[model samples]
Target chain A: MKRLRVDRWTGQLLLARPGACPASTPRTALRPAAASRCAAVRTRSTRAMPEIPTDEDYADGTDHTRFPPLEKLPPRATSLPSPPPERALQSAKLAALHARLSLPEKLPLQTLARALVDNSADENPLFNNTNLAFVGQSLIHYHVAEWLMCRYPRLPMEILYAAMKGYAGPAALHHVARSWGLEHAAAPGGEVDPGLLQFSLHKPGNAIVTLGYKRAEAEGLQKYKWRHGISSRVVFDDDFGQVVETDKATQLRRADTEYGNEYTRSLAEKAYANCARAVVGAIYAHAGREPAKAFIRSHILSRTLDLSALFSFKKPTRELALLCAREDFEFPIARLLSETGRLSRTPVFVVGIFSGKDKLGEAAGPSLEVARNKAAMNALKSWYLYSPGEHVRVPSDMLAEDAQPWTPAYIDMGEIIGR
Target chain B: MEAVVTRPALSCCRRAASSAPSSTRLLLNSSLPSGTRQKSTAARTRRALNIPPHPSFLHPNKTPESVASRPTSDEIIFNPPSSAPSVFHTPFKFLPKTDPRRMANLTSNLFASSTTIQYNYSPSSAASPSAETTTTPSPESFPSIEGPPVLKPRHHLTPQDIEQMRRLREQDPVTNSVQNLARQFQCSKLFVLMCCQAPKEHQQKIKEQEEKVKARWGPRRRAAREERHRRMEMLFNGQL
Candidate 1:
């Protein structure tokens, strides 16, 4: 098999094969001193070619029986900062990870190895997973957002944003990468195994592998805690419906400290998440969309999240009343359905909110007032939680060849009232 | 046989519905002027039939709900068949009954109760020592001889009202208990306590009253309160 090429933009070492033509010189010019050092190594290696083992000799048990002596190079020897592409084939971890994910045969080990390298580890775009991660992030975010929109059609903008963060956010993706048993290299270098996730914490790169429009007000968002309207967020924010801030430089500076800070931890998390995204991107690029989607479904979408817990209502009763008014339904009335130990310190009062004769929602609380409030909240939740069915088809389902005719999914008129 | 009978009935109903609109339109035309009649009839018919205007038509944007009927029932319960297990239930079936994770999953489910379950208290059980004192009082006898009224407190006190409350509290601290002052001013007991400027002696007395109240609480009650407070703190801190 032809050995993988490390792109020259990385400023890493370009090892020359003994028999390879001298015409295949490095594309980018090295420093004058580094160029002289490379020329010397090349001439010496060519003269010592007779002593080096050939491919055929290594195939037999002769060289494998005894440990080979380590070759010591000069301190200034030029080499790839991250593991070379040639090492991808020998990485047992990479092979095991490939098998564990059950990726298609079409996806080669080289692409998977490249996916493990973060932009920080190798700044070269051609070598790092930045481009692959961008593609993967889009795919993941698209699936996540469409699924969320279809499943919970009536989720308020805030809750929807929270749910997106809970499922497809950096923290969530980091959790996914961790759960897959993918270990990170202590520090990124040519010596580290290609299987491990490689990213440098000390020398961070500006690898914002996300599709989002950085809002005009993004600069002041963190500094002032500027109020961003939900409408604007949909237009300007990332897939998780958050303002995209370009603060990697500040974060990198903070990460330089010996003791790991929040910024450093988040940087690591982003790197791991990007690696996971890059894997998905590599799969999509090789095996096509269907297999990539299936891989995502099994690994990411299958995890359970309680969407109801995302809700935080300020005045549920008022909201319910407004919803009823908008729908032209009967005004909701809270009635005491049941109670126990009414005068006791720990009384349990069950209240039901009803619109006309139909019971909207029911809840129990320590006091009647609290029970009534809870019942109102439940009523609002029930109204908001209307789902056609669990098997409701999303927009992407139409992408399949044999997909049924597109049926427009149910869409609500957003929240009854915004806070 | 049922299909044969229902088919004719359905056809007759359909025919009646199709013909009624035209007849109404004709009636409207005969009674009114040409220009005003067309506009009035269309508006009247739309309202009477509750039919939304065509989207392409030059009309005001109608409420989305106007085109769709509201759900008759508030709750939509989907119960899976007992014989065949649902895909939803399959994920949790692997967990053993003793697993605390299973308990959490069950509690966080849509129908989980917010209130604590009262094991000792039941509606069907005979009146216990606490039951008689806890009987629901009539609205007229809200401030019953047994206890204070369960009315919601209002907190719209003016500056003058606060002054009056302070004066009342200072004159007779013993008589003006926080509860009594709260009831009088239609405010929370805590609010009344915060607003009042009691003398040093009165503050000492208030401390003693607080201790007495604390002593009255049973060990189980105290423990339950503490547990509840701890849980609330954990929830607020996002630790739980």
Candidate 2:
């Protein structure tokens, strides 16, 4: 393979083919030799080089020469908010991370470096990873939602939203980024390493760039503790079914006074989450859908989450009764199946909830009432936790060309009784 | 053609009961004849499999005569008519005894009986049994109540009552219990507790008592309690 060197002043790639150095042209000639010699000199030079050319020097358009002074060129030539794209090649950390993730060869280091530059670090749209992160967020949310829907068809809306957050929310993704052994720059600037995650800690930027419609009452939502219906949230909120608060702009304006340790920590978390999303986005853009989906499944969806613990039942017994009524079954009745040491301080009572002759659920507790309540709760949980099978196919499975004719997935009639 | 068209609309209304409003039902009812409408409504309310018995006038043989005549709803009998045993009843019965899941199932099912019975005996009846018992305590031996205790009506406490309560609390804050004050004032214990102001010393004593009780908990119990609290926090934070 022929080595290529990017011209700093003109922003053009000059290929150095073997035995053809293009010596006849003045500007093109002596480029490869001088670039190689400068690299060797940088390693050997004990003292720092002289100050690089200012922006004016590039604008003056100096005359072409056979031997260009490589040391006089700026350390960073790009005027972008982030480090120059050429730095991606020299970053050892970036190379290690790319290999660690086993990323495809097609996914270039430049895109990976761009993924690390959060919007908070670089406000410029051309340089930052905002667009890539947006694409990644959509793909991640779509796969997660479909999998969760097919896997546990009976999860209530609240539990479903909670599960989605548990898998793909900022805090969860922050943990994902940390597990990848990613290091963040102390502060984001053009001088910082391109490999390190660059995001400002003091200034709270608009880190969340989602394709969601903001409700008019969003301003008053947190301040007034407004009631946002679950259905409304599905329409107006972000992918996780949460209200997308765009108050970060206002918060940033007050950053001088409002900036605290807690605020900075949360900002760091959001920045890390965005970086993870951007990486997924870069994979999709470069390598296409299959690899990106595989990456998400292996990393994010593979994590364990206890779906049963997401329930917070206010009245389990009443809900069970209503469920029986709705299903037109026999009214649920709690009965004491057995007891031991009833008079003792640590008495145990076993209770069972029966619908007709079927023992719906059973549980043991310290008291008869507690046991009965727990039995009722368990019965409701079992009914809600029904699954057709582990390998139930989702809608996305039909996207494959050779997939068999799609069969409709089993969907329950939602929660038996809403709170 | 008319019958075929109406059949789809009728079935549509029936299916719409779950998702649509009752206005569609009203529209369907207006089109139906009164006589058939009542019959259809009754059929819609009936469950899929279990057909409830009609009145005796409508069906004489369907009436339940005794305890055995009616099926008990005490426990659910799977495959009510089938005598075959359920596969789920002993799903892991084939597994080795040392398997954790099998052991859990075994221990859980140890007290899985389907019935409960309670017996009661009178003292006088017990005393007369076998003719060797001592004199039994008669019903009149205990003082009889005239009637049920009357609950004090709300909003009956005067300004003077509040003043007296305050004075009593101020005089002996440590000795006064919220319950005793409530009984004296003929009000709820919560109201009395809210009204009474505890001194700093009393508050400190209460805090010390709570701490003492908490200190008595074993390491395992403490860890379990903390774990429960952490799980609750995770649930609230939507991280679980």
Per-model DockQ against the true two-chain complex = 0.02, 0.01
lDDT of 1 by residue, B80-158 (tens): 2223111122122222244344567553322222121122234433222333232332223212121243344444789
- Which segments of candidate 1 are over 4 A away from where they belong? A1-78, A248-250, B1-240
lDDT tens readout by residue for model 1, A319-385:
8878877776766667676678988889987676665544566667776666666666666666655
What lDDT tens digits, residue by residue, belong to model 2 across residues A20-134? 2212222233124334311222333232333234547343344324333333323434334577665555566787898899998778887999999989878877888999999
Positional deviation of residue A280's Cα in model 2 after best superposition, in angstroms: 1.2
**Which pairs of residues collide in candidate 2?**
A356-B75, A357-B75, A357-B76, A357-B77, A358-B75, A358-B76
Model 1 chain A: ten consecutive residues of lowest lDDT: A69-78
